[model samples]
Target: GDPRLQHISQSIRVVPHFPKNGIMFQDITTLLLDHKAFKDTVDIFVDRYRDMHISVVAGIEARGFVFGSSVALGIGAKFVPLRKPRKLPGEVIYEKYSLEYGTDCLEMHVGAVQTGERAIVIDDLVATGGTLSAGIRLLERAGAEVVECACVIGVPEVKGRCKLLGKPLYVLVEPRQVDQCF
Candidate 1:
């Protein structure tokens, strides 16, 4: 309904061969620096779920924390951090999944979401769908009805969308082409 999506797309910085060769790393730090763009991104997400009866917002480790917490605050829901092993305190349930490089695990506190609470999982990007998929499994196992998985960006070329196992995925934007940075 507005130019917020364009702002988000423009604020991201694409780095060539980051963390490895042949990888175009999509960076969002630039977006964070642009207060308006950042706020709009969160507002867009909040608007989507504010009235959906979402009791919880499950944010994946790292990037998800940025937008997820804001959305939770805006929507009046609890924010749960789905973290790496040993990051979450007390009794936690974990799910291990394979990524392009290796296998990793995500852990959430056992009581983060009570039985039947509606939740939405957030991540910065969906690359290969491993991280979001694992988060969904972790939440579902604990009896949370994951409303949907949301990401700021999606690399459809990686086929992460297909690996979601029928869960709805919402992305703000996909690169128009591999060569287009914004």
Candidate 2:
């Protein structure tokens, strides 16, 4: 990882027991607040992909949108948003993946990605790899060759990378875990 990424790693705020128990949530909202850190986060991604001949950058909903659009612009690739169900109004294709509780789906507009286009998926964090896997499947099913998945933070202990089906994953920071001290 780049030395500058240290700042990116430190900027993340970890919240314990978020929406449940014994779960440490790696939050990037704090990173979004620091202008330099935020810009650096996007810059690091842009620099990595700018020379890769990438044609499409698919962001996995909500948080992925933040970095994806900027990276697409910087890399001269088209930005494609893989959204939640029914969030897109046009013709779409979707892929569903399992979660700890239930299943969730990701939708992409039909014809958003051309056949044989090289693409990457961006998100803020990757935990279970379920959502990222669905995003890759959605793009691959559309005939796009998914080149990689990128994220700001990663939780290695959860082994999210195992679910990506051999697709490469890149992360700027490995999360720092702290006990729930309140």
Candidate 3:
């Protein structure tokens, strides 16, 4: 059997009516406050791909940076950022996708991932998988082989798993609902 990953699964707080009503946001600040939890979260990815030849760790913007940077550092790999439009400097490659509310675009430096390098995309959570999918496409277009995609949390109700069908996905925690607590 695959190693049980429940220990790293944490119950995070949910702030109801956040940014808008009827939307309960999964707050990861609680998990960030715990050092052991943070380390374990990073360890989950490091342990899984320790032997793989990962040249870059591509982290989705904002929350992804937190976990991705640390994992990249731990594994002695370079960290690349997948950011929202206009956030990154220099020549950037862009991909547009629809969000739950509206459409948005993600940008990355043209040369962030070198040709033929292996990368692991990291993010804090996977919801509909739109952003993650865009990230994968962007990396592939730049000639990077996406070895895997990993996240700290995954919300299956939104068809997140289906969006990542062809990729190896590793999540530290798989929660039924975004609002569900540990």
Scored by TM-score, the top model is: 2
Model 2: worst 10 consecutive residues (lDDT sum): 156-165
Estimate the Cα RMSD of every predicted model relative to the unseen true structure.
Answer: 2.5, 2.5, 2.9
lDDT string, candidate 1, 56-96, tens digits: 99999899999899999999999999998898669998999
lDDT score for candidate 2 against the true structure = 0.87
Ranking by TM-score: 2, 1, 3
Candidate models: Cα lDDT each = 0.86, 0.87, 0.80
TM-score of 2: 0.92
* Model 2 per-residue lDDT tens digits across residues 4-45: 887877777888888689877877888889899999989989
| lDDT, candidate 1, at 38 | 93
User: lDDT (0-100) at residue 85 of candidate 3?
Assistant: 92
Model 3: clashing residue pairs? Answer: 11-182
How would you encode candidate 3's per-residue C-alpha lDDT over 1-182 as one tens digit per residue? 23434444544556777878876666677778877777777886788766798989999989999999999988888999999999887999999988987999989999778899999999988878888898898999999999889888876553233437378777666652455454
Query: Which candidate gets the maximum lDDT versus the true structure?
Result: 2
Rank the models by lDDT, top first. Answer: 2, 1, 3
